[model samples]
Target: MDASHHPCGGIPSRLPGGGGAPRPDARGWPKGCPSTVARERIRVPEATRRVKPAAACIVRHNYYPDTHVRRDAEALVEAGYDVSVVSLRRPGQAAREALCGVNVYRLPMQHRRGSSLRYAWEYTLFLFLAFLTVTALHVKKRFRVVEVDNMPDILVLSALVPRLLGVRVILYVFDNMPELLAYLRGWSARHPVVRFLAFLERLSARFADRVIVTQEMPRRAMASRGVPRHKIAVVLNSADETAFVPSAAPDAGRRDVFQIVSHGVILERYGVQVLIEALPSIAAQVPGVEVQVFGEGEYRRALEEQARRNGTTQLVSFRGFAPFDELIATLARADVGYVGMLNDLVLPNKLMEYVALGVPVTASRWPTFLHYFPDEAVAYFRPGDPEDLAAAIVRMHRNPASSRARARRAKELYQDYRWSVQREVYLGVYSELLNGVVGASAMGSRVGAAPYQRS
Candidate 1:
């Protein structure tokens, strides 16, 4: 878990002090020291020496501390692969650092929300920088696999050099770009620009040796777009249970107030406004009802205004982005977790985290939500309908026993998609692609298992 910072964009040629044989650190410096300190001779673990050296890199457009990217990178490290993540450099973050056994190399660029042209320019610039960084890292690390997570699906092109060098490339589709674009731009799916994104998506998928998607819906979406079905694998973004523990029994002191929590980027499509609109009805039915909004984004200002206009300003509190542990603590205390997305395609990770913590959830009845959570496990409301959402919340508040029972059911259903189970599935994708040679033993008896073939 030790991390060392480097100011340079690429791997440092040598440590700070004069030369000696580079030593392996706890975070796995396979060839060279990740730290800049003087080298010293140290005993390498037998397991480390016996295992075939496999290096992998993940290229993501976001900053470090990204839950999905961190989970995947750490899983690789645990499976005996040296993992590195290439991402954006946010303010006050190190240019290069090792975290939780994964080495992170952040570029100089920052992510900003703006017009389509601005987005295009930023994506293009990051793509170019990533290509250069990955090419340079491969020269030293010789990564056996390069995985790219997408906002712009074409980021997979950053690995072109490595792909040409016989390294396996994986395009991990976090979201269906075309569908997201259509939703954000209010354009028809058949719009020329949306269709162009679909074209790029297909090309990206075809370029990768395999594609990893969050769930079955996106996998099917990719397959229908001419990306071969077998080439795609589903890796659910379930909560890391070790960090997100189930809440202790309800406190009698908290019974005076109904606490509802929703956390994630505050975008219009996420439907936070719908939740705010429902707050008045919820408070009227269940007095002392309070809503905690966590995380910040472009739509926050408008959401605050809407809360004020609805006369529910006191009922709703916007608690901006908090640390992971703090967020989990907040979720654990909630009487209900709210997911009010207008879009049906995304399976929100926040929903999974809520379930993981044994928090009762009232979620939008999106196809993706229904696909994952059975009717008995969650109380679902019509998406973007304030009245239905309010009714759902009131019902849960009035029927505490039913709410807890439903939460229990959710925890049970979550077992099928929790991180431990999905991590193996994720590693299996790499194992299968590498011909069952790399990390095959980590997959245990499922070594040759067909890469998560569940439809």
Candidate 2:
């Protein structure tokens, strides 16, 4: 089913922070001073260099180049935690190697994504192997915390042994299973599968000592399921300034045709196809318009076919994937950065990258986005409406001054949501967890009994 027809709750239409907003400083930044140092070299305490990390992280995928994970792990290391990462072994990744002061461990396993049964088999095997790997590492040298980056939400179970041994378990929810499945399978909230997955999601959150959500909607989802508000942390996936700072030559020169670009995972619900559909219309108005896609996924071919059907085959260009530096260079030269995602639940990294580089953003005006970005910083368009997106493109093309103003505000807004702010928020959570500052009842409630057993 096309995402437009998915039976789900309608996103609120009002803009956030307009009526009454959270104090920007109170949100995460310091009360008086701006913190932008994560862009520079992170300082590691020589005194604590040899000390054990505050936590050990187990990510299902290889972490050598995962931007956010790498950024946060480095922050933790610099903050006196001797972090270790257990990740998948890619084609040539060493089974054991250290990167950026974090000791790395690899388990040999391949992943598949086509079928439900295949996913279950792979996740189950990973849950089992990751359990053994983390347990052994803990026995060798204990860590105070065990962090799991969830895809298979229940993989937090891998940290059971350590939690039983007095370590804290943190489940970082990159994506929630319920909404993901409902959106992906085009199932209604009332669907049995959706309900079952929601049950499992709550179950996993209940088992973890603390839950971290990448965005506010997921936090609400957990809280609605009876998880205490305090037990969950909202760690916005802010961009690291080192990698996403404003381009040295942000406003170089636009080609005869305007460039609209998006770089990230190619997913159906993300509404990139809508962007492609809008291209033909955009070209009608702004004859100088091109769409540059710089990512790959199962959805790529479908988008290409759609472009062909829309007669935008020549207008939409897929550059596949490239290193971050190359992406930055390409984006620096773009006239407008595109983020047309329809999912109210997702906030793609492309949005942050585009805004940081002072590129005018044209995104689906989902309410959750309003919470983070004011309407002025990002041009609003109806989700799943290609014409609306085309209208936005035309507006930017016609009134470059207004577009430039929005881009300037976007760059200014980016500072408040930088990695420095989130790094501090993350460390604060760990500090509370490590210092026994969180309410004891909440900590004890989850750790009393973890759901999995590896023995």
Candidate 3:
């Protein structure tokens, strides 16, 4: 259950091109060019002029339209601050686009960099390009807040630039970066890059004006690492109720069979195999339970193999990730939402999204769940315990009324965890940064660089 100790599937060390490992780039640096101007060319609008440049910039190397980043950045924009996101653009998306009135700039990524060295070089180049974009955007318009979210804690170092420039740095810690690295190496020897990243994480946490984590576990972990509780705010992932709300019920014919659905990246930590192996037992007990997995990842082939091995290939189907609207449609059709994450340090955000859609969620039990979900709210089975999971699935199938009630309750509870709440928390953070109430020196008064703690 402790994935921090699990060995990760081996990944190549040198990406193609032998470029340095990718790190988040400096704000306002030009994309793909070193000598180009780093600042923005556009003039600041009068409406935005009243609002001081945010010391914080939401930074992530991950793609845009990522639910949380987009939602948070949009909320920040509504609160009247300059927000720019630095991330990789998929081949199809344009280099720049304004969505929900927020400026989103994407840099080209070299996915072809097959080796780790090439990947690192490409990513570093990405960072530099992103920095140029950020600089141009910021100089053209002042920004005061620099927020770093997503994985690869090396990006945390980006906070240093803003801090040096007198801007407040906020760490929106989502996943634990070092734990992820160790997992990749099968929890074996630590790599120098991982060590350096760990070092950077410590420095960033120590100096960050505020620390925002997704769940209580990370907050406590950060606290143990010396981040004060006051400086840390627990910002759990919230569902976009407006986008995910259930639509009118489909016809009884369309709902003739019970549909169980799961989505997102299909990776080891998602524990899809356990669920597949449990299907035979579930089928023996429940007459019409069908499990559909949405999304693809490293573990997909293994999952297919398990389904074939278990002879439940007929009941289990692999449906890859769908567009947002289509995903909502699938959620609407799904009677039970299967929520899984290899019992590990991080909680699965999809579970929250599932609950928001008002679907009864059945998940692999993890310690992280205790922090946010009530025992009654979810039907939890031991991590990787096929029998327990099958039994839980059977229990839900046999008790449709109870399942329906639970789903209704989950939807009602979803309001408390909605972005409406997160918006206010972010606004408070921005206000704190703008007032300069918290300074870099104050941050230094906190603990020094400390290694990330494992469960």
Candidate 4:
């Protein structure tokens, strides 16, 4: 994928291929760099001046190497939209950069943990920087759309200035923010801050020109919160098939004895505790059933302590956060991949990624999983039920043939979630916005085939 060539419309003079040296991304993550995940291809006719080039500005608080955002920007660019992303600094990113044809600007900040002071400082700084970026970019470029990837739910404000400038704003929600924070803190909605956040969330949803949610439950949740059903679109959080390709089966010696893997944030909301509590029974029933827990989060320490207390610390290993290839390789070796969420309004992205990897999954019996895996591809265990989780683990370990069969079935189901299809749906949203198509059913009809809406 050459950054020089536009996938959809004729090349613009501003793009590097037609002019002087390409603008060096201040962030180390450079555009068209081999190290970054490339966007999936989707064909759109070269956009002419008849349609104004839509400018997309993404506002995200916490950052990851998001392939969805990358592909979303790429699709808009291919369709002749000028793309600019505004996000907070992650570990290795520079303050600014151009990535695979997208303008990415980072707000610099000191890393802080869970202190209220830190949260205030971070959000305040992000808000200030974001407003500056939006004002500067809009003055020079004609951006007609602003996209907010929700985790903090504060990104919806990014559209305020743009809307005042007559640009449309789309809120792209990946997780249910209020519920996620409550899950993380183990606090209930009764908490004052939780209540305040819920209020803010409802207000944000109301302000968005269009709302996008990852799962059906969140879409319903948004509607319940007073966001009209017609203003929302169900856009799922998906893995880029371009990055997580299937690899050759590993040599027997290279695989764990009784391999089990779980990715994403290893936190309580993910039900890592159930896996922790199941470890002792699983170890006794199937000796040397080593478990590999990937990603880092609040629950990591608790899980490690539980393993130690149960005397199964030797049997469990924490791989922390691995890079892209290592994470995929780890997934490829998993005999039984785990997926879970504390009954939330959104599905976990890992469920789709694991399924795409063709691994037999043992997931919590939640509406989110049920929505995705109606087939026997996913083996259900009672949510937070350690005994049930242990039994499910032992069953898969005992029946390798059944596990492999489930893996094959899961892969077949995941075929619908290919990046090409996902990119097209996203582009449709941008096209709708650029063409002044904002309604209950923008773009004429819903993207019914999105795998995130599995049911």
All candidates' TM-scores? Answer: 0.84, 0.84, 0.78, 0.82
How much lDDT does candidate 3 score?
0.63
Better of 1 and 2 by lDDT: 1
Among all windows of 10 consecutive residues in model 1, the one with the lowest summed lDDT is 1-10
Q: List the residue pairs that clash in candidate 4.
A: 9-46, 25-97, 26-96, 27-94, 27-96, 31-99, 31-100
lDDT of 2: 0.70
> Candidates' lDDT values, in order?
0.76, 0.70, 0.63, 0.66
| Selected candidate, larger TM-score, 1 vs 3 | 1
The residue-by-residue lDDT of candidate 1 on 49-163, one tens digit each, is 6555688999988766544665577666656677889998866667887765678898998877678888899999999999999999999988888999887799999999999
Supply candidate 3's per-residue lDDT for 78.
Answer: 55
| Candidate 2 pairs with clashing backbones | 53-82, 257-288, 258-288
> After TM-score superposition, what is the CA distance of residue 265 in candidate 4 from its true location, in Å?
2.8
Off by over 4 Å in 1: 1-52, 246-248, 323-326, 436-445, 448-455
Off by over 4 Å in 4: 1-52, 64-68, 90-93, 185-192, 250-256, 439-455
